[model samples]
Every structure is written in C-alpha cells, then in structure tokens.
Target: MRSSYLQTDLLSEFDRLQQQVASLFGGFPSSIRSDRYGSFPKLNVGTTDDAIEIVAFVPGVKSDQIDVSIDKGLLTISGERQALFANEESDDARRYAQERYAGSFRRTIELPANANPEQVTARCSNGCLMVTVAKHEASKPRAITVQ
Candidate 1:
C-alpha cells in the first residue's frame, strides 16, 4: 500500500512539473515563438571570410507578408500572419479547445561588425528566410604570401 501511494505522488509531481514548463514557454510572445510547438524561430548566423549568412525559420507565413531590412547594423524582420479562421466570421466562442498562436510578429537581429549593410541580400524559400551580407572589398580576406 505504501509503494502505491508513493508512485501516485511521484506521478502527480511529474505532471505539475510538465505543466510548469509548458506554461513558461507558452507565454513567449508571438514575435519569438513562431512554431506551433512553442518553439521559437530558429536562427543561424555564420561568417565565412567574405560574407555573413543568416537564416530564420518562419512557418505558415506567406512570402509577400514578410518584410526584411537592415539599418545601422540592425536586421529587422516584421510581418503579420492573418488568423486562419477569421474568414468564417463566426461569433461562437465555445468551440475552442486548443489555440496555438496567430497575428503579427517582429524580430530584430544585430549584424556582425564587418557586415556590409548595402550588400545584404535576402530571400524567403519554403518558410525560411536566408540573408547573406557580402563583405566589402576591403574586408574580404586576402592571401599574404609568406616569403
């Protein structure tokens, strides 16, 4: 009997911990949490001697809706994802069981020191935004022949 009670208590504790973690990440603003699973948009910023590359994951959004810009070393991305069911125009509020997220979101990233603002090119392909900032001629790596 004691072992059964201990097992039940452990299960309850586990449930509470799980709920806490979910709530913590669930409240993350839509700007960062683009994924339906409460995961934030994943971004990778890398540098290769001549350029800097940035990739952001943004799903369920159209290419036309997204706007990307770079200013003063700041890369900003903004967009609005219209609600999926807004067209139905139903006023029923009792049918909701699970709602992940919806609406506008914006994210800003700081560019690297050698990033050339004017040479940045961005493209959105299959829900991922890829931005490449080519370095200026002066910043590109040059081979120094060791005599």
Candidate 2:
C-alpha cells in the first residue's frame, strides 16, 4: 500500500539520521569519562582565595611512588598501582574478574593563568594526592578603596 511505503521510507530516514548523529558524538567522550576510562586517576579541581587545589584519588599507591611536576603551566601526576594479587601468578589461579585498575598512569592538567607554579606544593595523605598552586599576587581579588 502507498501508506505503508511512505512509513517505511520515513522510518529509514530517521534511522539514517540517528546513525549520523551517533557517529558525530562517537569521536567525543562524555564529560564524566576520559579517553582511557580506567587508566588515569580521578581528579577534583577547585580554587580558594589563596590557591588552586587539585586532588587526585590515588589509593594503593605509596607517597614516594607518586610524582607531581609542573612545567609550562601544565601539572602532571604520574604513578603506579600494584596488582591486588601478585602472589597468584599462575594461570590456574588467574582472577575470573578484576575491576581494580593496576598499572602506571599519568595525568596532565592545565593550570589557570592566575596560577603561580613557583609557589606550588604537593602532598599525599590518606590516599589523596593534593597539589596546591598559589595564585599570583596580582591575581588575588582586591577591594577597591572608597573615598
């Protein structure tokens, strides 16, 4: 029937449009996810009146194993995580399922223009790696004097 033919054509057109839209978004990851979803450590970036705070959740990694560096306004955090079952190295003892991520990973964050890398400091405690970048003297908010 003529009506059935038009409906089929319309459905096919919608399917094609959907495929095109999905393809367009396929190249970009969602905001909540990264390119390598399980590779990099999760991070929280915030700011205070005095400094910018970057906290990286790095459980199971020793403080000495973690490295933090700032170069050209890019802050980098690199470290390694050991496997949960290193002693079970045999094929028969292989884990049927493992969700934990274990390996070397590196994450880089872009610091704001107000960030002063020279006054940066890093500390790791309670499985959190906190990096603080002081704000430039001129960047801090100032109250104007009223005559």
Candidate 3:
C-alpha cells in the first residue's frame, strides 16, 4: 500500500512539472488537446524608429479571409482556415494524425502606449500578415541642437 501511494504522488508531481514546462514554452505541449486556442498562428513583434511591426504566420489563410482591426489600443487578427481534406477524395482515407489547425481563430495583441492607431497599416503576403503601426509624433524622440 505504501508503494502504491508513492507511485501516485510521483505521477502527480510529474504532471505538475509537465504543465509548468508547457506554460514556459508559450503554452505549447506534447499533447494536441492542450492548446487553449486550438493551434492558432504564431506571431513576432518588433519595433522600428517610427513604427511597430507585427508578423503573423498563417500558412493556409488567405488575404480576404483575414480581418484586422484596432480598438482601444488592442490589435485583433481573426480568420478561418478551411480543412484541407474537405473534398470527397479524402473521405475514404483513414486519418491517423491531424496536427494542423483548422476552423476559426482570433488573436489579440496589446498595442504600446506610443502606437498611433490611426496610422496603422496591414498587408498579407506569402502567407504572413505584416502589420505596421506608426508611433505618435509626440511620442517619438526628437533631437535638440546645443546652442
């Protein structure tokens, strides 16, 4: 009975450690069902002297299917990815694994305080969404000449 109790405790501890590791790696896990958003696209954020840049990786999504919007200092990207095996030819195939993300997904990113929502621009090219938000004039750095 004591050995069984020790085994149960070890399993619980292992599960806790696994969850912590998953959270550290941007919520990615070994199990398919662990994703809270159902395998949405990943993004990269950066900033230039004048603008903030965001690139979202959406391989199967089209330009027209995506919706980009900014409201109250939040940038939202939403779209739907149709299933690849929708056609009749795939109906008879036995599916062993499906790791791709299908269906609708929405991701919201918070804009910086200096970001100018009015000067935002977004374009989709080569399965990536590039969004640029210009910084406010008052927020940009200015040089003062020494007299």
Candidate 4:
C-alpha cells in the first residue's frame, strides 16, 4: 500500500510538472502562425488564379538592400538593415533617439510543388516587398467541355 501511494504521488508530481511546462510554452508561436509581433517583416500570403502572391512588410528597407532567391521549392529573403542615427545637436549627438531595428535578417518560405521557379518575380515598393510565383501550366484550372 505504501509503494502504491508513492507511485501515485510521483504521477501527480509529473502531471504538475507537465502543466507548468505547458503553461510556460503555451504562448510560444509555432511557425508562421505567430501574431507578427515577434516576427520581423510580417508576411502576407495569398493565392491568385495564376500565381501565389507574398508580401513582406519591410519598412525602412531599401530595394537594393533586399535579396530574394528560390531553390528546391524554398524561397529565401535576406538582407541587412543599416542603423539610422536621427536628430542631432550642435556637437552631433541626439538627446532622445530610438532605433526600432537594425542588422541582418533572413526568412525562408516553402513554395508549393506547382510553383514554377522560372516564373518568379519580386519587386519592392512603398515599404513592401512583393513576390509572385506563377503556377505550372498543367496545374492551372481550365474549362473542359463534356463530350
């Protein structure tokens, strides 16, 4: 009877430990399902009739500073952000200055199997980086007439 009580206590302790761990990691995000606060350059993905559209909100990043590439059905976007020092006094020092972000950032996105790498297009404008991946010819929807 004593050994059985010890086993029950051990089981209860393990259950409590598991609950504590779960509560600690419950708020942690899994992949892109995040709320975008912890993610840099939040992404918007959508599918059109002809292509898969992706937009990365990259404010204060220049077109030249951005790099986009695709290989093995994985699209990668990487770049470095230069630090900005704004507002200065007579001697060249700021009294109150805040820097939101700086340095290198890299993000990878998995493309669909039907996405044609050759038809990929990327453009940066108005603080947004837009990427379009065209679908394969055979994967596109088409109308068929019944015989």
Candidate maximizing lDDT? 3
Question: What C-alpha lDDT do the candidate models reach, one value each?
Answer: 0.76, 0.85, 0.87, 0.82
- Tens digit per residue, CA lDDT, model 3, 38-67: 548789999988999999999989999999
lDDT of 4 by residue, 80-131 (tens): 7766654322346543533355667888999999899999899999999999
User: Could you tell me the lDDT of residue 133 within candidate 2?
Assistant: 95
- Of 2 and 4, the candidate ahead on lDDT is 2
Ten contiguous residues minimizing lDDT sum, candidate 3:
30-39
What tens digits encode model 2's per-residue C-alpha lDDT throughout 36-84?
A: 3454688999999999999999988999999899999899999888877
Clashing residue pairs in candidate 4 (N, C-alpha, C atoms within 3 angstroms): none
Q: Model 1 clash pairs?
A: none
Q: Give candidate 2 regions above 4 Å deviation.
A: 1-35, 87-97
How many residue pairs in model 3 have overlapping backbones?
0
Cα lDDT over the full model 2: 0.85
In Å, residue 139's CA in model 2 sits off its true spot by: 0.3
Per-residue lDDT for 42 in model 3? 84
Q: lDDT, candidate 1, residue 42?
A: 61
Worst lDDT window (10 residues) for model 2? Answer: 27-36
